[model samples]
Target: MSPLNWGVDSAAIADEELLSCVKNNYGMPDFWGRYLSTVPGASEGLTTNEINFLKSNGIKIMPIYNNFRNTVGKQQGIVAARNAIYRAKRLGIKDGTVLFANIERFFEVDANWLIGWVETMFSSTYRPGYYHDPVQGNFNEAYCQAVAQSELVKNQSILWSAEPQTGVSSKTKIPRFRPQKPDCYATVWAWQYGRNSTECPIDTVLADQKLYNLMY
Candidate 1:
């Protein structure tokens, strides 16, 4: 198995001071997942200065897009991809980065949306990824169904599973890699093992080495 790296995803703005505290308290992470656009009641978007700070500190960046309230259909998915790509470019993100669509558990995700997302991203400079729970629920069902029907989604798109929540751990006591398996075969690249940490404004993630290639 590939070595796993420690990382964090936060809904709050990870400023230098906050990140410095995180480094001191939780150890320096291999990657930091930030949003391209803010999601109400969820996350704040990445700023240019924040991006610069992360890059200069040698921390890789995982870009997330969470502007949608509902995973409606094909046209909406295409629009979301375009919006994400535009934001990424505006932020000076280079080609070939993986832009993850943040599909929360509450969203009504569908196979058509997944197909549209994959196809649109495949046509763009950046690759496609989905941040969703794969253990069970409508999201998992839709994604599995979509993968079964579309080879493009099955082979190319990446999955970041938010499952088997173990809560926050100290830097010296990170949890073992035991995320829940997806219902179907997919490139499960990153696993969010902990969330809404009380000690910090971040969630813990274990990333497969393959995920590094997609980071900024």
Candidate 2:
């Protein structure tokens, strides 16, 4: 396996000044995950200027879609995927990049939703990805069943696991890349090891080098 690369994801908008500060204080991250849609008072989505700034600074982008609270049915999954695609195109995201659907720890995820999400994305220009805690509660059961049933999901989808909460670390003191693995057979592209850092409004991550090929 290639060496894991350090990165960060944030709900707050990382402006030029803030990004500069983050680089100055913390080590430069290989990538930055930003939201695809702007929720009114909750999180800020990426803007053209921010995207340019990040690209200029040599930081790759991981576009995330986090509008849904529950993964209910196939139709809901299709709607979510379509919404994500629309937002991604509007933001000038290139084709073939991975668009991740953020499935929170507390959210309910079902195999139907996962199958629908993967199938919809497989037919689109962009690839499909999911961010979820596989080991949390009974999520693994549903995730495994989805993969077992859909070869498209098992073979084409990329996963980012949010497990083994290892708290935040300093810029110079990044923890080793030891992410908790999912119980099912799947390609885990990245791991969110440290979350909600007090030093910054970001969660630290370590990604498989191969993930770079799917980034925007």
Number of the top-ranking candidate, with lDDT as the measure: 1
Cα lDDT for residue 194, candidate 1: 82
Off by over 4 Å in 2: 170-172
* TM-score for each model: 0.95, 0.94
User: TM-score of predicted model 1?
Assistant: 0.95
Tell me how far the alpha carbon of residue 147 in candidate 1 is from the true structure, in angstroms, after superposition: 1.0
Clashing pairs in 1: none
lDDT scores of the candidates, listed in order:
0.87, 0.85
Per-residue alpha-carbon lDDT of model 1 for 1-216, expressed as tens digits? 688888899888888777876887788988999999877887788889889989898889999999887697989899999999999999998899999999887788899999999999999999999999875558888888888999999999888989989887756688777777667888888889888876678888888888876799
For residue 53, what is the lDDT in candidate 1?
89
For 33-143, candidate 2 gives per-residue lDDT tens digits of 999988876579889888998899899999999987769789889999999999999989999999999987778888889888989998999999999887775567778
The number of clashing residue pairs in each candidate reads 0, 0
Lowest lDDT sum, 10 consecutive residues, model 1, at 168-177
